[model samples]
Target: MQKKQFKEVVVEVKHVSKHYKIFGREDTVKALNDIHLANDAELQPVRRGEFVMLRGPSGGGKTSLLNLLGTIDRATEGVIELFSSPITPESSDEYLAKLRLEKIGFVFQTFNLLATMSAYENVELPMIILGKLKPEQRKKRAIELLTLVGLQDRLDHLPSELSGGEQQRVTIARALANEPEILLLDEPTGDLDTKNTVEVMDLLLDLNLKLKTTCIMVTHNPDIECYADRILYLADGVFEKQAINIEQTRLDYDKYIEYLNAQTHGTH
Candidate 1:
């Protein structure tokens, strides 16, 4: 396995930390102590076109780090550089919102699709919000994205009509509606069955390779870590370590299912 070649920086945290002030609690909860991601000294930063996964035990601050990277929440201290733009605690909400709309895409465990919107509309909503395209352009882009996610035939299907996997695919398609530079996913496959989980990860890998869209995903499944170029382990609100794959590989659906079944049997 060759060392991963450090590329352009997409996300970097410089000694960042986060603190939460509970109303009744006298001491602020330190969600994240000092952390570092993008740096040349020993630790390497996430680069453009890289697939990075954050993994750790519960309350390990994976989501806290992710939130800071996503600009959904500002850090209590230090700076987060997104595409070389500094995100400080003082960064305005308006600026962050605009940045999120223009550059970042998010997909979550639950398919937060609008119940009334069909697949096409859901995919088109982002572009509409950004107002980056005309109605005809948005329509064309929506169809293209749905097709890209293998939902061309289900364009008109509502969220309720689609299966969990299909709804997730729609969510993925919608995330890419505006062609975001980076996609931040939180437990994207948490609600999925074994088969769907593998399928969604494969789809994500395909998109990552084909589109070169950097993926920063939070996942608990160690079995599928092969899909990432690098996996960062977070614990106690700090980066514990990281592992780099020889090369990203997709899981064979049959073999993956078999492995899961074996694990289940062994556990009992």
Candidate 2:
């Protein structure tokens, strides 16, 4: 085995746990139970420009962990360090909001593009909220992002007019509008057909490499694990195991589709 290179750590989870309270019940649903990430030598910490994937069974707290890491939800116990700054349940919402706006970006299974907004407008919205760029600057960045995502020609098209893959590309462009250091993706390809899935993952891998953005993604597809530098498996709300890839890889669309077809046919 090759000695894996390590980089500066950008995100750390220390003994983090999460649970949700039922509005009218005494019983609370435990989502994560005292999990550690990027904390041990065996489980290497997620570093700058590292692509990590969280995989586990349904209801195993994969999305919950992603949410906590993204600062969209608070951990019930322990703290998560983002860019070396600690975030606890007591962290101020205002501060977290600012951090998210300036440092973190998110893409989800649902594209979440506004129905009435064009691709350019969707991509521009984040910069508008951040308010760091002038109107013209935002316009230029929006176009650049859309072009980067291969949607330059679809800039004026509404979400409804775009295909599943195109809608996902728009979402990815929108997520990058603020030039965030970390991009959190929860099943960004979950809604796509196999062809689109291959296309979208390839695009994400390209962007991750090009922008040097740390990517933490939650995915159910094990076949695509090669895209990640490290894969963390969560089961019953704990880190079940971890796997590190010496190098990132992509799925060739034609070969992947052929393999899927073989699997389907072989089952008969």
Candidate 3:
């Protein structure tokens, strides 16, 4: 991978607010309220492979924040600057859409794969839609990505044929196909089993270190946050606190699962 332009500010979110207008409801819900975060606060520039975790409960603005950073959703008020470019624009929807497709990579909770297509074909769909490469080259690159995700043998398998873990892996491969500078994942392991969750998280960490891809992930799982270099806690649409630990957080994947399950069932 080519070296990224280290910015004094990779992402500068200045007093941003996002509100969703419901069609039937009288009250609009505020997803993000007066959120301010400087990517390079405290004399720290954004380096490649800088991992950040946005931690919050389900109702909080974690997903909304990720959407803002991804440039897929706009804030109702305030400025969002990415790579020194104003993402929260006053005009032009065309520009924002263009930026999202070319600059950012997204891994969603649903996996978002075409059920009819094979794993390799699903991965190449984005390149085809973007017209980024020729058919032959796209095919080759898709195979290469699948191999990287340990899905070399399952490339020709359909989504229905593959396990849920394999499907998510294909989604990950697709996300990397664009070779984006920043990867935004929302609850990537939310649907996976314990073993698969760990495997997926491990793969993401490996990619972060090896490819130097800047990663921003949102999750309630503390174990998942362990992979991050910095953790930002959110509550009631606000940044509550932040923790910076250069070392990985002590993560016992099984223990976390047990705790979560116990909470779910209220078992002793």
Candidate 4:
């Protein structure tokens, strides 16, 4: 079997550290301590179209690393670059926001959908903020993405009316609204049941394969790591190990659909 080859470095972190000072305390907490993603001898870049998983115990700075990679937060020390461009602490907020809007997508554990907005509207919100597409274009694209995530029937449903899995799917559709090159997910399956988690993971895998989108996800579930090309384990705000998943399996959409159909028929 041939090994999958990755092209172009998407993210690079070098000796990064993040620190926070506690209010009313004399001590400073080190959220991340001297994290080096790519060393000199081994340049392990997160390449385009790769699924990289960050796994660690709570308070290990996994979310913090994801936040830095997504450009949501700046590292207190060291350097981070996206697509070879350095994302320094001095980078303007406007620039970072624009970069995030244009090149990056984010999915949160909370499913962060607006309660008042219908699924379609929730998906359309990103494009509206982007202001690049016309009303018809946005609507058409929103429908396409919602359909892609198997939520076409739930287009008009509000978040409250949808199940946790359905709401998370809506969020995924919204994240893809601008067709970002990189997708950042923070514990996407944290709130989902086993079946829903599998479904969501399948959808993500399909998207990553079909769209060639680079994905960086923070996960606590070891089962989720099976789909990742590489897993970075962190502890106490530092990387402890990096493991390449030789047995990583790609979920075939056709087979997945067939399984879903069989389950539906069996239920009825």
Which candidate should be chosen as best, given TM-score against the real structure? 1
For each candidate in turn, the TM-score is: 0.96, 0.95, 0.87, 0.91
List candidate 2 stretches off by more than 4 Å: 1-5, 39-41
Q: In model 4, where is the ten-residue run with the lowest total lDDT?
A: 36-45
Instruction: State residue 148's C-alpha deviation in candidate 4, in Å.
Output: 0.3
lDDT tens readout by residue for model 1, 109-228: 999999999999999999999997999999999999999989999999999999999999999999998899999999999999988999899999989888989999999999889999
**Where is model 1 poorest over a 10-residue stretch in terms of lDDT?**
1-10
Better TM-score candidate (1, 3): 1
lDDT of 3 at 141: 95
User: Could you give the candidate ranking by TM-score, starting with the highest?
Assistant: 1, 2, 4, 3
Cα lDDT listed for each candidate = 0.91, 0.91, 0.82, 0.89
Expressed as tens digits, the lDDT of each residue in 1-268 for candidate 4 is 2466797888889989999889999988998998886636253878898989999999999999999998888899999989899999789999999999999999999999999999999999999999999999999999999999998899999999999999999999999999998999999999997778888998898888789889999999886677888999989999888889875575555665676687879952
Candidate 1: list runs displaced more than 4 Å: 1-6
Summing lDDT over every window of 10 consecutive residues in candidate 3, give the lowest-scoring window.
Answer: 39-48
User: Residue 266 in model 1: shift from native, Å?
Assistant: 1.7
Clashing pairs in 2: none
On the 0 to 100 scale, the lDDT of residue 111 in model 3 is 89
Name the regions of candidate 3 deviating beyond 4 angstroms: 1-8, 39-47, 249-268
1-268 per-residue lDDT for model 2 (tens digits): 2334557889988888998998999999999998877557467668898889999999999999999989999999988999999997678999999999999999999999999999999999999999999999999999999999999999999999999999999999999999999999999999999888988998888887878888999999999999998899999898899898888999988888788888989952
TM-score of candidate 2 against the unseen true structure? 0.95
